[model samples]
Target: MSKVRIYTLAKELNLENARMLEILDGLGVSYKSVSSTIEEDTVELIKQIVAEEGTGSADGEAQAAAPAESQATQSQATQSQDAPEQQETPQAAQASATAVQTRDDVAPASKAEIPHRAPVVTIMGHVDHGKTSLLDYIRKTKVAAKEAGGITQHVGAFEAQTSKGKIVFIDTPGHEAFTTIRARGANVADIAIIVIAADDSLMPQTREAIAHAQAAKVPMIIAINKMDLPQANADKVKTDLTQLNLVPEEYGGDLIVVPVSARTGEGVEDLLEYISLNAELEDLRADPNGQFSGVVIEGKVDKQSGVLATVMVQEGTLHVGDFLVVGENYGKIKAMMDSAGGRIKEAGPSTPVQILGFSEVPTSGEKVSSAKNEHAARDLIASRASDRRDAEGAQVLRKLTLEDMMGPLTTVRTVNLILRADTQGSVEAIQGILARKESEDVKINVMLSGIGAPTEGDVLLASTAEATILCFSVTAPGSVTKIADNKGVDIKSFRIIYELIDEVDRLMKGNVEPVFEEKYLGRAEVRMVIKHPRFGNIAGSYVTDGSLKRNAKAKVTRGKETVYEGTLVGLKRLKDDVREVQTGYECGINLDWDGAEIGDIIEASEMVEVEVA
Candidate 1:
């Protein structure tokens, strides 16, 4: 009879090689390793043993489950029906209560008296900075080629066994979503490595990683990558990092800086050694017998598995078949795989594993834990869903009220603003003019002034400082307005410079009303560009949609980027002059700006003043 390898047989049995090897040893079968071949007779005997032990299958009929969408719908219905007591509370209250209860169940097990486990390291940095290359060297795999847009699109977890011990790495993708992923990675990480390219060193994304790491309060190591390049400068990197508060150990700071080449694998061993040493000092621990709980590092819906999550166990061991509440979803862990893609029955503390069998993909960083029972898990998750709804409502309704403005009435009055303008000249001019408005009783502080539409970043800064946004000759987009609304951020737009100043002056006396906001009217695509001596640029275009009226403010766009933003000087149809152009009709457009090009898009819009609220 032909022989089968232990690993090949383990895959058929959905068992890890270690477990299969242990079973073989118990059977008194002689084997060299997992690579050793076993006779067909031995395989039959193992199957018989597993069957008799009732671990193989059931004596009943097997029924195919409903499709994924139908099953998800059924689960939602079941959850609603199961939580009657929660229905009595208001939606916001119910959501808040559920969120609290769910969080309590999902919180990682306490570290006290926990057992020691492998350190989980998160690699973070700017794009094209060798973060993935270093991971490739360590794992002996080239995975970057498979990534979309040549960037890691999702957080990946894997483990490597070395002479010292096993190390876990959570490779985070480099994208704008890094804001969330990097933060989550650091939260569950014992150590974070900031990969700085030796040549182009610090970039904007690098600063973002630094801020995330510092906010998470995790130990950070510096990896000076690309030492093989001609422009590589280790001293320059060290100096730059020192200025950014990542002081090197040699420079009397706590950070460990290692110069390495991810391509040639130079200095990698030293980096590993330092990480292991740092892990020793930190003495990270997990309770093997504690309730299995962790956080979702990253999650996505899979057509095959339905919902998949890359989870990192913090305190206890997570095993297949345990009922779990992951974020706002509840399910039994149907299967678990180690970082190596080997099927593992259980995951211990600090172990990152790919989990299957969730009804819905959980949010990254959401608490994941084993509940007392299916009912308990469902209830906890349902509550969390409710709490999230309540939280979102509370955030939206928590706008500044008249009663909250008592500070301006009694104490030293202060109005913090983030100013944005259409031009640098306008920004400078506004800054100079606003500086004159500063008074002892009512000081006006422009916290973060810039030149452009009010952005989400401005909203975040405004939220942080409890400030309002003021912009001139620039309109906030619908998307920006939506975010600002969600954050309860107030954005006031003005056309004339004096109008902006007048509103602020009115605010000192606590009198304010709804301000003007732009409403987009139509869009036209230029098919022909003509120049004239009197008119700067004449654009022959067709109205793509809506109606473009004469003298309406228009924005010219090249591809997806906006190029020129100004009002139309005139509108004409062939030889006759017209007031507007409607859909499916072509017209000649005259603007004060030059350099109008074919294939350019022009969008017309108007500003309408309304009540403040």
Candidate 2:
């Protein structure tokens, strides 16, 4: 057999481990395993094995030993020190040396470190269900007590530092507030603390809260509150909760049910502990180094300040003086205050803070961002507003298409119609008909449709939705009409639906001309009243500045204001009926009223025309 050595065997292989085994088995190398502390006898044995293999001559060994002579004398003696030809085999020696080095490089296994984050808890229930009170109890503050009424008026975010960590609580004023705040609670919070009044069991708000939380896909903790009340029933509350798909932790489910009394501070600590434990299992974490982003919980115009907005920082840090663009508004953060009213220089991820210095009040649930500067913030806000306007315009245009009116339409074209009716049934019927009307170009969108006289809110909603106000057998209040006129919102009243529908159709067909009537400022003298044979009495009056047409709608003016608005039932030129009555012309005008006196001036005017909307 050919003489074999470990280094020679190593040089003839591809894989490192295979090379090591080839050298060991082929050379018949029988030696003790190399320990951490090398023994001199073991080294000698390895040298003897290499020598016995005798793959090279003495002069080749001399050349191999010569290269290591200056570094180590013992290694030089073991290496080939004979012919200069042996120096070419050092690459094989290096490979064998690498294999030996790896044997000593073994390390123990390690575990990965887990990240941590603040717990996000949401307080939810029906209105007046003690959700706010329970949150106040857990937070050890008087947030609910300080509100306008005993109930919370808005969505409030607070942070409570417990023994485990910090727990962020979002207090929404029942399910309506939750839906109003971005239409869902899942978007706002991670865990939901459903507060149910023990005495009431399962109320409408309670079911709404559960539906919202489940829709959000968040874990729920049932807080059976009002245990201090004499009529409280804990078991009934639990059963009701179970009916809403909330199985308690004790009943083979993960949900925790804690009985508490927001009025008496009972079981508050236990509730907090349960939340903390749930958060631990969830392993919630946020990247604090990311860009500052959060949702606007609520906003309002301050009497002292310009626009005050409450924001919940979901990630990164928001500092005071940072330029922020919230929805359509932009401003530098003049001040940052926490829930406790303490001034904060900076707010990290999950911290809810009230900020001052916005130009306008951003809508609740609008995402807020920290820009680089005021100019940048303004540009970003303007860009976002432009984008939103474009999107809304496109949506409106799409809704006016045949495809939008077809079967199984996903997007509904809603034109907010502020309906004011004389009676409740009238309002309901008008709304129902308008809602069912099939239109390829335009559909009715009623935001605030009520039965009473048109109020300021109706005008505001009309202005906001760019919609028209439809009054059925009712009139708009003076203040509301003035506001609508100022805002350029069309307000139309109809005694007949067919006429209104026909007018709307004509308007939609682009054939209807808008009729604008001059306001009847106050009438001059009623002049004289004459009794007629066939018709009723006529008020012969002189023309004011504007021409009064026959059958035109007019208001009966007495002093300086209008008393009644009706059609000019009769316009006769000295017993002869005329179609047109001009200014500076004497005409016999028969008003549509029985109580028209001599002093009561017959003011002629037409109804302000609005495009069918």
TM-score of each: 0.51, 0.47
lDDT of 1 by residue, 1-613 (tens): 8989676687687774666777899999986545467899999998777666553245322232346667899886887899866555478877887787556355444654456799988888888999999998987732222334342223368776665588888766442233344333325777888899999887756765665565456787889999999989988888888756677755656678889999998889878866776676577777676667787888888765577788888867888998888666688889887665657799889888888878787777677778878999888978989999999899888876764643535577777777889998998898888889877778887765666787665665565456788989999999989988986788999999999998888766554544588988999999998877877668999998999988889899998888999888799898788888899999999987887799999999988875442
TM-score of 1: 0.51
The local lDDT score (0 to 100) that residue 345 gets in candidate 1 is: 99
The C-alpha RMSD in Å for every predicted model, in order, reads: 23.3, 21.3
Task: Give lDDT: candidate 2, residue 176.
Answer: 43
lDDT of 2 by residue, 1-613 (tens): 2334332233333223333444455656552211012234533554565565555666678887867675687555556565446664668989977876465343323212323568777788877879777776776642322434332223367777776678888765554444445432226677888888888887745655675565456777888899999999998877666654566654545467889999888888777767776675465766555567888888888677667888888877899889987667788888988876667799887788888888788777677778888788778878988999999898777634434233234554444455677887876776667656747655654444455677664554455445567777888878878988987888888899676666455533433345354654323346787877766777878776667777777777778877778888877787688887776788887876656667766666555754433
lDDT of model 2 at position 367:
79
Best by lDDT: 1
